[model samples]
Target: MNFNKIAAITITGTVLTSTGATLAQTTYEGDEFMGYASTGEAVVVTSISGYFYGDYSEYRDFTYTIGNDYIEGTALCAGGGTKWIAEGYGEYEAQSEATLNMVRFVCEYEGELQ
Candidate 1:
């Protein structure tokens, strides 16, 4: 991957609840990492399904989930030959089951990754 490419990602969604339908929208920016992967802000669409919208298989393809996501020790930053994370974390309603969290990762690279 070219480390010099900077991208902005956005996500939008809503939650199905008893009280009423809830809407959620979040955007994140990639923080530059001089010579490594960039950091990003959290935009959780929901607890489990919201965070990863691209494809669950994609993460499973490229990541190793340690344990319950959100738990600091349970989740490890994956990708690249080394593990790195965005500048932010995903935000979800722990007690709310009908909520959706959308998370976007903005990657700001510096050098080429080969």
Candidate 2:
């Protein structure tokens, strides 16, 4: 093939790859939360603090969109005092003014203390 054709193909491939990566996942850090969003699911880490058992603990919220509906929940971690890591899952209800109703979700999470 000609050099021009090869260059065009290379550029097209690069653009496609970058676009797919961008759509697959995104992450953010804010004053109150750190979060990441994937194709159908999102995770928000809202709080991290010292706990009785270990140096730190983590609390997270999550959301997953399904069609026109969505599911949301929270997760908490209670450190093992020495291992510095923990895992837990829970369900909760959230109020959305737009929907004028309550939504419930189940969440599972794991974290390590810094």
The estimated TM-scores of all candidates read 0.16, 0.21
For model 2 the TM-score comes to 0.21
Clashing pairs counted in every model = 14, 1
Per-residue alpha-carbon lDDT of model 1 for 20-79, expressed as tens digits? 222222333332122211223232211121122221111211111212233221122133
**Residue 9 of model 1, lDDT score:** 31
Q: What are the C-alpha RMSDs, in order, of all predicted structures?
A: 17.6, 18.4
Q: Which candidate ranks first by TM-score, i.e. highest?
A: 2
Best of the candidates, lDDT: 2
Candidate 1 local lDDT, residue 52: 26
lDDT by residue (14-51, candidate 2, tens digit) is 32232211111112222222223323323333332221
Worst 10 residues of 1 by lDDT: 55-64
Model 2: per-residue Cα lDDT at residue 57 = 44
| Deviating ranges (above 4 Å) for candidate 2 | 1-54, 66-68, 79-114
RMSD of 1: 17.6
Task: Output the lDDT of residue 58, model 1.
Answer: 18
Worst 10 residues of 2 by lDDT: 98-107
